[model samples]
Target: MPQPVPPSWKDLGKSASDLLQKDYPIHGTSLEVKTLTPSNVTFKVAGTRDSKSNVIAGDIEGKYVDFKNGLTVTQAWTTTNLLRTQVELENQIAKGLKLDLATTLNPEKSTKAAILTAIYKQPSLHTRATVDLFKGPTFTADAVVGHDGFLVGAEASYDVQAGSITRYAGAVGFSAPEYAVTLHGLNLSTFSASYYHKVSKDVEAGAKAIYDTKSTTRGVALEVGAKAYLDNAAFVKAKINNAGVLVLGYTQALRPGVKAAFGLALDTTKLNDSAASTAAHKVGASFTFNS
Candidate 1:
């Protein structure tokens, strides 16, 4: 019988234990290394124009990475950043300055109208640069100088449901948040310095003052307005464009990265000393895409 085969099993156990002990440290270190991923990294790529609309409109750019520890990188290409085009800028000016002749004045398809026709169509022939400056704050001086289109202050109108007429005096003023600056205490046609501020994320409040050179008709007005984002895809705004009317608008994000903006504007204009007022409502819309 014999205590005989206590078995070589003891030798097998010892070998197994030795192997486990030797590998334990290595296995733990491997796990720790996996957790401590490298951090320093960088990536770059080019982008193309966004063409969500019939016309291409913007540029794109993209990137992501860390640069602290080792090089662990991530990156993305970006879209081109396209700004408003000359045509788009001209459209904005037209929308802002356009008069509704179909209703305000009699519609005519003829080659003859009046000072009004020239007033309405003058922008079309003007260079793109002139068109861009039409309603902009920076151009009142130039407008007064007659280097381009007329300024808002230059034309005073009196419109009513009965009739309306506008007297072109060629005036200009710098519109600002608290106050406006005029060229001369007399020449309301030129503004020296203009400043404006946002009252809220969607609201703006401001004022403007103009001096009359030929007459003692210096005047000033207080203004208030709002811009509302209806949704991630839509928005509406109501702002005062001039003394007589308000501007109301709606904009929709039509597609992924694409948008359309449209507005119905009401302008109050004076035609004569009668102090009559009229309505000139216009609807304008444009589409834009950002890649």
Candidate 2:
């Protein structure tokens, strides 16, 4: 069997912030209230509901920073049948090194799990190593090196108790003002390449191809997508894949702190069988209020 390729910086997809700003319905109705003071103290409360599942959740969190000691503390609570608490402490050990310690506790069960992480940074390279001291020990480490427009990264994970390496991946990529490309691999047998280009000031296009070396049939898939920015704080994106699946989404900001989005997905192959099963769609709206 082929050893898994370690993860590198190249595997990261669109970030949550990007998706949220694009009005993706990944999160249903969300409301957040936050307060910050001059002394680096902060408090926040957020609530969300899943329109499809009708599940609701809320979180309350607070943070305090001691700049003189280079330390910060954060605590959070999640509302549920049994309340869960999480606490984290971060300290800067030196100019370019930091440590993070965190734990999650379930009061009802009196059970807890801890995590420790160390991060180091330099002008051209960054590294992070983390350990989970839970039921079974696990370790993960990754590093990235970059200069100018080119970058490369590698990542690996091990199961300490099992005494074996479990995960590995890597990526190499470059970005220019007008174009970007990345090659990523997993477990030696699976690989993918992606390319993106700025077609114009308001439009962008991208494509991706994936291959599995071990597969006898259906070993490859391809997808292409594009985005267009319209006037007045609105944008649209569309994508299609070799499997005859298409997705289209549109987002618009009505005013400050208010946004709405709609998305539609269609399987052309399913259309050939039945029209009712061919299309799926979702609509979402969000509002934020700050004091």
Candidate 3:
């Protein structure tokens, strides 16, 4: 039998988090437009405006991917007149090993770089390590072990100059075709439980609860979300948090190569409060075109 590689430690609870957060409606007024060319280059412009319709903030970014050389380059300019660039190179070193190097540059700030190495040793063992060089080098590593449908993983980051561990976390999860569950902990203070279920071919549902032992509040923070595919080219998603914050989004393919999305966010508790009505709702839209 072929050895099936397991997910990285960072992605242990990704399924649930993605359902609850990713592609969800944007909060506040904003618009984003993106265009992708056939030559593997993407151009994007996005911004939000104030009540007077004056552009308040935004950025323009362009990215190009060179598959023939295993390289990707991204550059962006912000409304603040800051220029930033990122370069990434990736390659497979062996059957189950891969190397990735990435660098970030900002003339206004500082430059940073990191090298990541991943190894899939067997059907049950997978490991990833990253070394960030610059502004106090740090070493971070994580490993995931799987047995049957169960998985356990831990991650830690060490500061070389300080000779100390900055962060540590662990997670355990079980995966099935229809459902998955994960429990995670960070530094023995913050804990989270996430569950994802595939309700049907067209629908997905997920929920997550977070509890901080050091939190002054005694209750857990909860979020529940779901996604439903209306057809091949349209989908809708909604999520709500414990604090009565609700988010809803709908995406549709406007044409063969164009897509549009509309999003809304609302605070249910403030709907009838005149003093807080002004901040009770947000809306945004996005469009994408790909060749």
Superposition error at 36 for model 3 (Å): 5.2
Model 3: weakest 10-residue lDDT segment is 111-120
Model with the higher TM-score, candidate 2 or 3: 3
Off by over 4 Å in 2: 1-22, 26-42, 64-72, 81-91, 108-111, 213-217, 271-281, 289-291
- Residues 98-211, candidate 3: write the lDDT tens digits: 565555555556544454444455578888888887745888999999877789999999999999999999999998888899999999999999999999999999999999
Q: What TM-score does each of the candidates earn? A: 0.30, 0.76, 0.85
lDDT of each: 0.32, 0.70, 0.81
Tens-digit lDDT track of model 1 for 59-164? 2222223333212222222122221111011123353233211101122422222121112223212111111121121111112222122123332333333243
Find the candidate with the highest TM-score and give its number: 3
Error (Å) of candidate 1 at residue 172 is 17
What does the lDDT come to for candidate 1?
Answer: 0.32
**Could you give candidate 2's per-residue lDDT for residues 1-291 as a string of tens digits?**
322222235334332113222544443576677778788988888888876776889888888888777777888888763333343334445776778888787787787888888877666677789899895599988887767757688888899999998889887877666877777788787898888888888988788888998878755888888888997688888877898877777877777655666666667667655545623333454455444
Q: How far is each candidate from the true structure, as Cα RMSD in Å?
A: 32.0, 6.0, 3.1
Most accurate candidate by lDDT: 3
The clash count of every prediction, one per candidate, is 24, 8, 0
Candidate 2 lowest-lDDT run of ten: 12-21
